[model samples]
Target: NLPFSFIFFNGASRLYRSEDFGKTFTDVSKVLKNYYIRKEFGINVGPENSKKVILTADVSKLKAGGAIFRSSDSGETFEFINLPFHPSQGMTFHPSNPSQLLAYLTGVLCCLDDVNARGNLHLQRTTDLGKSNTKLHTNIYSFGFAGQFLFCSVIHNQSLPRSILVSVDQGDTWNEAQLPPVSHEQFYSILGADNEMIFMHVDEPGNTGFGTIYTSDDRGILFSKSLERHLFVDSSGANDFTNVTSLRGVYITNVLDINNTIRSVITFDSGGEWRALKRPSNSQCDKTAKNPEQCSLHIHSTYSISQKVDVPVPPLTAPNAVGVVIAHGSVGDVISTLLPNVYVSDDGGYTWWKALNGPHYYTMLDSGGLIVALESHPDRAVQVIKYSTDEGQCWHSYNFTNETFMFVGLVSEPGAKSMNVSLWGYKQENLYKTTWLSYTIDFNELLTRDCDERDYVLWLAHSTDFGSRTDGCILGCKERYQRLAKSSVCRNGRDYELSKEQAFCQCTLADYMCDFGYYRVGNDEKCVEQSDLKDKVLEFCLKGKEEQSGSWSRCGVERIVEGQTRPQGLGLD
Candidate 1:
């Protein structure tokens, strides 16, 4: 059950741990705390050494102004290994040597252990691991040591995409990988898929549609085949493309397989070819601004390299089955809602299926193998979370207690032990998490109930409760159908049949509800109900109603109190 592991998070101190994978952890904060305020990158664990564990960390910029930490005693403590010339963006341990290490710093590069630091781009040699180093080049963004070649992605400018650079000589000059058509303009991010393959997600100039792909056959150079449609959006692009799996490069269409020389680029072949590779489709760049229910292709990768952009939906298919109902800020398609009655296909946009209907609120692929769907029903006092392990065939339900919500989103930030998933409410403003079942979200303490004019809750709450604040009551009046459905009779308390317009009048009080024999019914003046004719007659009786025959109708025959013969019409009438 434990998976040969243990894990912990102090919450207060922000300390975390996991056991069963290694015997000990080493810390190196002492060497790093002198430079920056805190660290950005955290500790990394390696294999056992002398009954001790190896750990690495990049200090938060606030703690020591950008330093790295290494630990050896299972994270109980740590020590400084060495400092490079500049702050490091990434770090890794050498496969053969215990002390030999590689670190990448912003604007500078180094391969060091405990004594010296050097390297600009291609390679930085360390005779004693961290003991000594030298600068090789100046244009590299990230580097990795694989086989006989030292590989790197180089960028002329940070705003521009970096090309793949490789060096046969250790820490010496490097040459750019020359592919075709796709230039540095198309290359945005690069990741070493494995020891042999390098994967780059291409981005275009203005960030429009899918970017292409280029493969490295030998090492970094000699990239062949301008693999079109393999492009992904960067962080800025991801903002517009809301789906998480898209930016992470987990789409089904974007393939990263190797056949000795990394041939067979699928996306470049055709949209049809990309469709054939579909398993569970990965998220892709969304073309439309307001269609999130549409399912896009999602890809999965074994290597820990950064993810590519969201995958696109194949062409000429039925609309997405993301369903008709949608709650704002809900996760899933984050784009168009595909048709409800359609099936998935595998040969590039030519496919079909009649699957389950999609929910509008929060949706998560749960660790328990279920896809949990949450809805925006505030009157229920809790948001509903439904789970479906077998895609959408069946579902189970869980109510999120102690929180008022309408829509939800689940996302994660990488952690020391495991990934952390944060549950975000659309209108709630406060975020929550439940790594353990007994999850306590101190959302009340973190959220302010003060209604802001610009806040989303201004429109989402129930209308009867609008203008008057109450817990779990969303703004705006309840929908007409919902209010009518809850009543005992067809017309609620009235015996009259209700029309959509009439229901709207009774609830919201529109002006046109007045008629000839009816009176304006509700306080807001929208509905009409029959008035009592008898009450009107009684009130007019003393005034003497005119007879139908045009004769005067006297009140008590000219009141006999005076006993004088007065004109009949002059008595009290």
Candidate 2:
């Protein structure tokens, strides 16, 4: 059973906690008797432990600022945090450590009144549940953590070149990153692939029409330009940047290509190179098209979600993952077409096939092991539901009910990688009355056993016809094979039943990582340019030979290895 869920809504400051999933509610607003609560409030639950809940609201309708109340034990009691400035909606909690919080300090500079009150966002950090707070940075636009490093972008600094600040020891010390030459760059934010790689979006200097994505592998110490294009950034909230990379290192982002058009691009090797995804097979392209590669398609983007702009478009309300894509695209220039048939991409958007040829609500479960869809066409009542275990290659059908209902959404746990899914909609029993209902399904009871050989197929870096696959061709200097599966996994950590063929890969560009003091700039062959080599040092090898030219050889120089091999499972530098 779940612990508890709380809500404060309906134009009332009344707080309610439900232990039985809305069966009955307990009013916990009394815990905040010390300070007056307001209808406008921001509530957050501790990411690690749900019991730790916190809220912020104006102290009173006539008060100048607001008060923050935090409760370590759900809503039974609340402790008011003493801070100088009012906390804004921008609050970030450490992922693993729930007690630490970073919130934007507001309502200070020119607030004079709640309305027409504008103030600079000063970043504040607290580790002791707001008992004490420290102002870390001022006028910071956004902040996120990569490994142990904390990054914040400085915005609206007229005296200084706008820059990003990094803190190695939490917020104790901060340093500006040695970013590549940038100019007239308007946006500043960070994108991380799970917490290891940091992708920075900035405008390259002397460039007029495009932006570049620079990456840092060792936190923010060294950097390299990974990709350059008019990459799409989601305007969901105040965040100037959003992530397109998934857990399996599959990146799906719409880029302005061919004519500054929205062509969805994907990359399997970090950002070494990117290729535009083909349009769905069912959509007819123009007959005059020279080739399929030049054909343009409008890729569906996860639109403004925090503002709830498109409630019917699914919002992708799921964590980014690999092997399954609920892509919405039209033949050409369908920017206004919000809904199309569901296009499935199992091979990381290399190719796509239409699975559902209508407007629909979609969700993925078990890291794309299961795909669910409910038709919500404008003219039709929703009843039929379809699901697939093999990434939409095949499907099984189920009816919603004997009668049709208005499809609201398909719901599931995001990033939890769970097998539970829920179907939600409103049933119209009479012309004047409607009933909201939700039916949940636990796949544990339905999926009886593990998948078999039929669930897997040998996967490669690129697509190939029956006989077009090249043997031992240097494609990203990858391992022998990639096993893609419709099933989550087999005992062998992959569901592909085929045997791996042995092949020794030559030292391709992928095998050689960026050299010290140098970084790659859209160039994959070698790390040919210098970055901020911040006090970089070299270690003595078995005493150093071939790479050590001139009289710097401590060991034998005859026939010694000169090349360095990239470590297994490292991202493209």
Candidate 3:
């Protein structure tokens, strides 16, 4: 797979390209025009060809006019493409055909006189990258391509039930599929992993109302309800039904009951049978709470679940893992202070475990690894990044010093071994700036680690190219390289900082020598700095150092005794 990656920075109105697995990025904003790109709608790269990429931008804040831009040479340059409609949304390319593209134009008037047209919202298709266009369908709320068939949820009118339309000839002709019995208040459909199945959700309003989810195995020909009555109490209603479906007919949904409790359920046979997931336990809260009722474990919709901050909440199923699901409790709760903030379930949401604590956002890498960026503590300003390989059973932490950035989200490159970490930052009055960082940890590497001291050091050294075994090292070397690379004083040693700064300062070898802020200790053959050494040690303990009493230790190491257990090679040997 190609190493090329691109990210749009909303605040700067620019795009960046990273060819080295997101380890480094170069400003590629020249390829884009002066228009503001829509990051929310997303940038599309051709599935079959990484060289072919497309982007959409708004001419003005009012969305007066819009433009589509294309790059044929892997984002080296871009050219403007013409669109039949302005202010469009949901830009997508054909699954197999790079030449074919589809975009949804909702609430945009085709003609000023046709304001009353029922088909005001229509889908436009193009085979030549927008040189011309053909209208595909109207009144479409959402559309997706699964294998060769294209599925769309169309709303004809309020009085009529919303229909699920399928097109087998690549949007040429459409047919309505039979669905379950439910009110047409709203309908949403998404294609399963392949085109073999489709999942639909219908919302019914008013009392005695409930949302019904259906599954279609015959390419949207016929649908059947997947939920059983016993899952919900008699006469009890449900709302806020969110689901994710896999290619193997595994479906997961988050249902909020009338009593405000949120239950996560999963079905393996396309909803033929369902199992409710168990809420993660809070042992610390149970032991310390005054009221026993406050210690009970349950997932509630209102204050129990964490509201998504800047980044989008993670879906039920890991994008890369078949049956894994990660969930967390809400922030700003008294009971949450004694509970882990994150939980994970590997058996399709049947069981759970407390993974980590603190405010953070996480995403699953294409390699089935999980990455999280969390605050050092609930009250601290420092943010640290953590990685979990064994499905969140244990984690390794990395702290970025001198970098003021917020975690945006993680990007999984299709068919690639590495994933890109998107972060946002600001520089004096502009708080919307963004940057892309790469995590080069491969799935194989994570699988081989034993989580021991030697394995940890080896992984850190190899992944960040830190110092040799004999030399001192910088904790979070990758992040340090990023922060120092941006400084005017340290820009000269950017390459060395990234690859060689972790080792002893070899003043004799110019290429392998240490950067600024590092000095060689006389006659010691090693680079040493009083301030950096303290920072490195402090970082080590801040990342879950253990004490002799079998208790969790942080920010400091306990005194070591003969035959007592402690981290080997402490104090940098």
Candidate 4:
């Protein structure tokens, strides 16, 4: 019983056979001659006879395109299955039947006789594995099976109605699937699976507004919604297609406006409820404290004395929430890099935990504990990613020879064996397989190697450590100072060397503090920074009192209130 084989395209398309479940492989490139530009490959271990094989190749030998190669006798010989030349994105064999095959080109899915092609979406099916061609659809970006039906979405078209549609009885007809109200722009990056659920990410239009996640069950007929408040700017905020693992009823998509905001990655639960895998909120308070509001004072006052000292203050706008978060897996709970150091919520955007100590960029498995991370350090050009165990209480690091973009990604599998830490591209080719170790034991051994030959190592610990602590919340005249100190300036500072606990605390505080001109003058810690004059008043009031070395009377109104306060009048002006 051999495991799956692996193939890749570096300078040219190359093939390899891994006899030991991807542990070791021997090059079989000699068999694939002139395999220049490879698009995609599909392999199916024959059911009846394990030796029987079928290989589809997108040999980009010519500028226009390449050829699809098929092999039956264990790669000993090959025959070219002549097909139309176009970039192929996916190819697969039917799960129930080995003889049935399907492949997707840029705009078409072709089969033997039944060709259903639209101007936009292309859907195809083959009764006799790559023997002939038939086009099914050409309207949707991508689609998949949904029981006896098909589900999919229209490709990138801002004008098109951003909606998921379903087709029963092959590609003969179509109907819009039930979905929550969202802008059409969000429809660009839609995908579906066979599992009867679809997820869509929607980016709203506005100045720094959040996006929404929409999910559907019953083959995209009805939908549920979840709001995501943070904006993630990755790949133009498009929903990444790499996360979903299920097919049929389950599909995924992310939404954002034209400005491109990575709002949220959501998944549909078994109950048909839209579950947010990652959600950001303005929740920074001591959970155990009976009265967390007692931590701060928000006194909203406006004393206008234009011969009218009894004037009242105007109404204030509601406080806005804060915090930024990104989900790791396809439909995991929302995790925040804000306070309690860092927090994770497994209950699909319901409750949260103060899981870690620092704001992390990469969170995965390592030799010791789970890894939480922080942003890259300017000094350490090579070491950007970091890992932590015990829920981000501590961390270990490794420095790659090359700068792999600092981030955390799932290991493209479950069971927590190992995870991908980063993705790197070289001048000659792209290195996507490189990964980081999840187990603490594996990481310790990985470090013992030369650790420099590879262009990039995508593991959990190869990055640096980010020591952090503290829940981010502060209220007072010195809030900015408190915030700056709580941020990387303090967490990554020379003082305590940015212990993971300290970093987490600082991040929490920084997240909840003011920006200097406005204050959260309410009972809630929801506040803004004081204005310069107010700050000056606060600064001088505190300074004058200390300088006078006495009570308010000794400090005197002239010295304490006159020069220090923003307004210059009698008692408070």
Clashes of each: 91, 0, 3, 93
> Pick by lDDT: which candidate is best?
2
Give residue 337's lDDT in candidate 1 (0 to 100).
Answer: 32
Compose the digit string of candidate 3's lDDT tens values, residues 7-64.
4465546677766555567877876765667777667888788888888866542344
TM-score of 3: 0.60
lDDT sort, best first: 2, 3, 4, 1
Instruction: Rank candidates by TM-score, best first.
Output: 2, 3, 4, 1
Worst 10 residues of 1 by lDDT: 317-326
lDDT of 4 by residue, 362-458 (tens): 4343211234354423233233445553333344565544544333322211222232233222222256555432211234343332212132212
Residue 470, model 3: lDDT of: 26
Better of 3 and 4 by TM-score: 3
Mark the regions of model 4 whose C-alpha exceeds 4 Å error after superposition: 1-11, 16-25, 39-66, 69-80, 92-102, 106-121, 127-129, 138-149, 153-164, 168-194, 200-214, 222-237, 240-573
Best candidate, TM-score-wise? Answer: 2
**Each prediction's Cα lDDT score?**
0.32, 0.54, 0.47, 0.35
Count of clashes in candidate 4:
93
RMSD per candidate (Å) reads: 33.2, 7.9, 22.9, 23.1
